[model samples]
Target chain A: MHRRIVSLWFPRLASDRILRINPVEAPFAVTHHEKNMERLYCLNSQAVQQGLVQGMGLSDARALCPDLRTGPANLHADHHFLSALLRWADRYCPWVGFDGNDSLLLDVTGSTHLLGGEEEMLEDIHQRLTHSRLHVRSGLAGTRGAAWAISRYSKGIVPQDKLKIALSPLPVAALRLDDATCTALQRLGLRTIGELMAMPRATISRRFSLDVVRRMDQALGDQSEQIEPEAPKISYAARITFPDPIGLYGDVIAGLERLLNRICNKLKRQESGARALRLICQRVDQAAVQAELRLARPMREAECILPLFERSVRELDAGYGIDQLRLEAFDVEPLPLVQVDANTAHQDSGDALDDLITRLGSRIGLDNIIRFLPAESHVPERAFVEASAAYTSPESKWPRNQGSQRPLRLFSPEPINATSRIPPRKFCWRRMHFSLVKATGPERIAPEWWLDDPSWRSGVRDYWHIETKQGRRLWMFYTPRHPAWFVQGEFA
Target chain B: MAELEQFFPLEIGRAHEVCGAGASAFAAMACGADRSDNARTILWLQLDWQSDIVNPVGMTPFCDPSRIILARAKNQQMLLSCAEEALRSGAVSHVITELYRPLDLTAGRRLQLAAEMGKATGILIVSEGMGSNAAQTRWQCSPECPTSVSDGHNPKTAGLTVLHWELIKNKKGTLGSWKVCWNAQAHRIIVVSEACQ
Candidate 1:
């Protein structure tokens, strides 16, 4: 069987897209900044008829037509629209790919009969796109290269046996060569593809590049070119469609229960679980209501997942009635099966802890529930790090600190109104006065010189564990360079 | 000392309150005293507005910081709900919460019921003096200065932290007062002397 390929070209994609949204009668052009000048990127049919070609400066284009409307070119939006068109083209055939910025290539081999024939498919696509106010030119042939060249230079279909004759009349620029290469080939009296092919292959490869010969062979069906088809996304979704729309809350819960059972059973078979899930309720009035859930751990049990959705489902308004309920599970992870024995049953506390974390996270977020992990630093504030309990497992052993005793509660250093190198006789803090009874020796701790810590800008500190007469033990540090005392923590 | 050993491990499945200057340290010691083989985790809840945070480096002297899970709540309602949920799960051996305002009798009763249902201990660290609540016991803790002694050259007190705890309210035991210090090397609390009334 012969392979059939189709090429589609959009002559004025940028200008047509803008005009489609807001129709204009005057000539319009899209301009982009290049070489420190605003040059025309694409033009509408009205602008083309006024003799304003692409790459012309905006000033020059204004001189040609006084009523020319101009807008900046948006390449990103054009590419996004082209991809949407690719998905729309999937109805014609499954093997659709992007050819260039302004064209699409579809391989309709063995499937053209379903659309009546090759000629009928092309005509149907042209009529539909034209009715939608889009200008599209299409060509069908046996090879991709031949189809591409025929679409831009000429119009019609090329049979499999006469591929060479159909592509011969097209200009040498249609062979997908650079402007410099095409100009050089034209200088040698080769203006058409037929003339270039009549020359000796060895002579052409020597004078020009080997790309010329390879392109010729590909267009003639002598060299094979493959088309890469876009893979469809895999969806883990289950839906229940009702004959009659249900508006009761109990009915919605019943429908959701059935959907969860089906989805959980499917996940159990694959030894996988979901960490994020989305529930979409399609209403009969053409409106959709969605609720999303995030779990701390991957779970597949129907009973465990059902309660998490209860609060969200109760809040959803089943406007008019809901005809369909769809459940989608994403962020999947592999969850191995564990057997339930006496020893394992006793260790179910871990599962209960995970459930508790998930419930709390639903209210206060998982980041607020934290566990402390020992950090490798000697600084009092940097000695430990906080990690979310949902993500990090608890460490079995914590490295013991062999330095001076640390305070029970730590605070960002608050300066006190005392200026004594030794413990003061009395000091005021938080509107209270405390008289020192006995104090320990100063433990000098130098700042880490490698790091530029703003908090440690006061240079080296001399720490003292002071006992006050008011039954309060405070950890105070004095900076010798700054000549100040600051209370950093409490021994509560 | 023998009678103190019986008090070392506070009765499980009950709710207690510790207030005053040394409440946090006393509650940390109580949480560390649970050396059971089955329950290994401890849940600690506090308000997000509290400026002072528990330092893991300092907590190492009482309990292993790795065994503690800290939860910060936005309001008092969230704090109490989190404490009740954690205590009712039975996954943790103890649930310790720091309360800025005193807990009412109804909320205290709910917490006590949760602890009983899960067979877990609940400890509340109140900032001010105790109020009317359904707690099993109430303790008032304060820091006490150690006695200074002169050896030969320099005169210094023994470098151990001393605290005085008074049992202000007890439903099942006698009210008493004792001065105790934490022994870091042995990882236990030792009674220094009975307070002179």
Candidate 2:
């Protein structure tokens, strides 16, 4: 079947609504109300038939019709609304392009097969637009320019070779020519395309202009016109509409398995893996929910992504049963196939650890599960640290140690008041009697005054590595002369 | 504006100043660091008391002062559980702890020697009444005014946590008690919120 193309146009569309407030069947013509007003003001033709006319100041138009609603144009909103139609048009055809502010050109080449046939496709697209509460004019033709002209002039299809006859009755303006060219052609009594086509091209150019001939040549396909169509921003989308809307956990689980497989298949075929997935659910009353799942690593596996969705489905607001499901993957990148062990098919040990962490993380949250990384610090108390399970590994080492003997345990030094200078005989702490046994010298380690380190607030430390009578080895230190002993740490 | 959660409000406690030789090494542990100087390390230590502990749950959270009594001075101290805990909290800016008996000879030398090599802040909570010679500060708390009464709620206590706290001995600050709020969920002292009594 030959593909059909359609172009739409709205002439006096703004004029019919602006100066003359007749919303429909309003015959109007719009000229510049202000000198610099670009495309502003429309003439009310229906109102003109009822004694309303253009160049009659807007105030007079309002005086002629008391209920006439007058308003300025919103050019930006118009463009935005038109762009939205451009996106919605994607559902019908792959090659929908913007024609103008009030028009859309659909290349319904292969798309007619989807909606049954050519007339049906037009009716379907028309019905969709009508349901959206918009007024539109459509025309189909074998040529782009002919379709545009016929849509505005005749509101029907202009078959191939019938272009000259179809565009004949329309005004010279239907040629989409500039005002100067149209006025020039009108002055020469060459007011129609057919009239102009029959005459010598040299005479038309020689009398009026040369650029009109170029436009005229291109419209007739004598010269090739290349259109730089914008392709959709290459997104990843997979969707499934359910025959029966199911709400059970088992049903959603089975559906998710199939859905994830399909999505992963698409990503794999595209040579990419999904970094993020959005699950969209359509339900009762046209209400819908879109749940997004983010991955720490880009992934493409039914085993990997499905389980994540299963747990995540509980968080989705299904609201009156989901009838349609869609999954879109984004932030995709090429993934290498994981070549694995053939000798022991069960020996994928690298993933075992990550799986355990992923499960634990899914429960208490990934942030709460952490592992310690050793730190490089000379301070005994600052030698170790913990990192979240997601960003770091459990067995990573922090560069520390390489100094003096660090106590496995460092305590707040409790002072033992010396009753005598001969390093006390016995002191009671926690009501437990610790008798002094084998003693060591007072290692008078002064605070490093040059560095101004704060932990050394006391003048100096006379540390003693002593052993208690109970055989519990102790490391005590004293600030002697102004003599007071402190229990700092223990030796294993 | 944010009302700090009745628990840890994403605000990890930070050490004001770290010293000893290896102070810089342990400096990274300050709750979070100023963005400009980002190299920081925090070591959190959780010491489960085997009893004989006064305010075992670090009332001042992390501060300690000491002097040697004549008898225990000849020998030293060892803190088994606390040292293990500090090595655990890698992101804790301050090495805060509480101990039943002051760290003796072996313990003090180990910690001082440890601080000398790295930048770490160790705040040990020592009982106010027990006078030892090793700790830097002996923190003690006496009951202040009875907790206020509101409607049917008891003024002296709220839920299971103690609310009113007073600072007894601080080696670096003006020697007096400052009020401390408490959180039961986090089991830590909440810093004061009001201007003054």
Candidate 3:
């Protein structure tokens, strides 16, 4: 089947979203600050009409149009708007992707005629977008390259038979070449697509970059170019519709339990388990309440999931009864089959740990649970890194007997007021006074210069493990840079 | 969430609940309880806005800080329910929770039952507030001054820390106080000062 691709260009997508929210009739442009200079990123139609162009300095634009309004360039908001438009465009075709910065590519090959032929589809899209106050230009062709070139430079649909004839008159820049290459072609007098095409292929490749020749060939349809369309995510969802709405919590739980069983069985058959699950309680009034659970490890067992669901299910207000219950299992992964060895103690313990993680994860979140892995560093705090307990395993045993001794717990560095003595006979911390019974040498630990730790801003430190008269074994550090002492850690 | 009832039959059970005095005291007890061999893994669940102040580095005195699973719930309801779930799983060795306020008697009973059913221990760290609950034990812990003798490395003694703990309520035993220190060499909580009634 012949492919039918549609390309839509949003010349002022970034500026347009802002203009849409606050309608502006005067000339306006989006400016991006780069290298200490504000440059015009994108311009609206009014700004373009006033002779302002993209990449022109903001100062020059303002000089040209005294009443020109400008806003900071928001690429994020533009991309977000494009994604929203992408969902809306799903009405046209399921396969739609944003091409480059300000364009959308749709593969409507076999789907266009369903919405009353190509012309009707284009007209519908144009009218809907125009109704929404979006300035859009669209082109439909047999190939992505042809469609893209036509959308930006020409108008309407270009049929397969006339693809080459229609592109012949356009400038060489229509091939999306860089300005240097376009200028080189212009200097060589090969200004139009027809002129570039008439030249020898080997000569064109030798004169310009391979990309230049490749793009020209792609535009002319000599070589096929594919458009990457966004793939819709597959949702593993199961729902039970009730003929009569059930009001009781038990009835809702029953329906949910039934739906869960079906989905879990399906997941088990697929050899997969869901890390995240969502229960959508569809009320009789059409309002839906959702309860979600996240697991540390992927789980498919009904025994493991249902009990957790029960608590969340009770939280949902059925409100005027519930007509349906839908359950979705997302973030699915293959649950590997483990060989049940005779050494069941070790295996069972591992499984038990995983189970504990999942249950705890469903409640507290997996990120908060962490495992410490020994890091190769002399700095006391940098000696270890936190890894998610559910995900990472320690690679090697912790380096024992590293410095004089690593403390059991490191505090967030509390400063201590101490006597300015070589051994500092007494010290005060947390409003409590401790007379030093005995003192150890300053174990000099230089700060890791590569790291910018806020606490380490004082430079190198002389750490001293001191025993206070209060019977406390304290790990304190004396920074020579600022000549101050800090009570950093407490043994246990 | 899709329920997978066809996979395994749902079991009904609850967990054991115990309350601790404060954050530091709770941390000490949790560290001590976790030292027991029964726990397969430890879950440290903190309620909303309660980022764990327990330095993992300092946790070297208790157990492998890496082995402790930390979970932060967004609210009190989530914190309670999550704690209950962790206890009921029967998978973890211990469940430690930090809450802004204590659970009521009913919720405490539910947690206790869950822990019993799961064969796991649950420790609830109540900050500032207290409630009448069905916990097996209620403990109050406070930091005690350290007393140590030097080992000739320097004139200073380096490795001794102590906490004074009061067993405020005991379901089976008499309420008492004791001074304990973490012995890093043995990785155990040794009672330095014997229990005083």
Return the top candidate by TM-score.
Answer: 1
| B-chain TM-scores per prediction | 0.90, 0.38, 0.76
DockQ of 2: 0.02
DockQ scores for all predicted structures: 0.63, 0.02, 0.28
Worst-scoring 10-residue span by lDDT in model 3 chain A: A394-403
lDDT against the true structure, each candidate: 0.86, 0.52, 0.73
User: Please, what are the lDDT tens digits per residue for candidate 1 over residues A1-492?
Assistant: 999999999988998889899889989999999989999999998999999999999999999999999999999999988887888899999999988889899999998988799888899999989988899988898888988899989988999988888888889988888999999999999999999989999999999999999888888888999888767644579999999999898898899889999989988988888888889999999999987777778999999988878767888999999999999997788888978788667567788888888777766777899999988777789888999998898884666757687899999998888886777889988788888987886998888899999999999999999888787899999999999888888895
Docking class of 1: medium
Candidate 3 structure quality by residue, lDDT tens digits, A1-492: 888899999877888888889989889888999878999998888889999988999889889999999999887888878988988889988888879988999989899878999999999999998888888999998888888889988989998899889988888888888899899999999888888888998998987779978897787667888777667655578998889888787887778788888888888777788988998878888899888887767888887778767767777888988888889997798887666678775666666667666666655666766777777888877877878877776444655443466665565788877635365787778787788866776888887888888888888888887877675567888887787788887653
lDDT over C-alpha atoms for residue A23 of model 3? 89
DockQ for candidate 3, C-alpha atoms? 0.28
Considering DockQ, which of the candidate structures 1 and 3 is the better prediction for this target?
1
Candidate 3 ranges with C-alpha deviation above 4 Å:
A1-233, A237-247, A254-272, A280-288, A320-330, A333-365, A394-396, A401-409, A423-428, A468-470, B1-39, B44-62, B71-85, B95-114, B122-197
Sort by TM-score, best first: what order? 1, 3, 2
Q: Report the lDDT of model 3 for residue A194.
A: 85
Candidate number achieving the greatest DockQ relative to the actual structure = 1
Scored by lDDT, the top model is 1
> lDDT by residue for model 1 over B55-163, one digit each (tens)?
9888988888888999999987899998898889888888999988878999999999999988889899886664446989888988885443222322221566678
Model 2 misplaced regions, further than 4 Å: A1-5, A9-97, A106-135, A179-190, A198-210, A226-235, A238-255, A280-290, A307-326, A330-492, B1-197
TM-scores, all models, native as reference? 0.82, 0.41, 0.64
Residue runs of model 1 more than 4 Å from their true location after superposition: A1-4, A8-96, A99-104, A107-136, A141-143, A177-192, A195-226, A238-249, A265-271, A280-290, A315-326, A334-343, B1-8, B130-132, B148-158
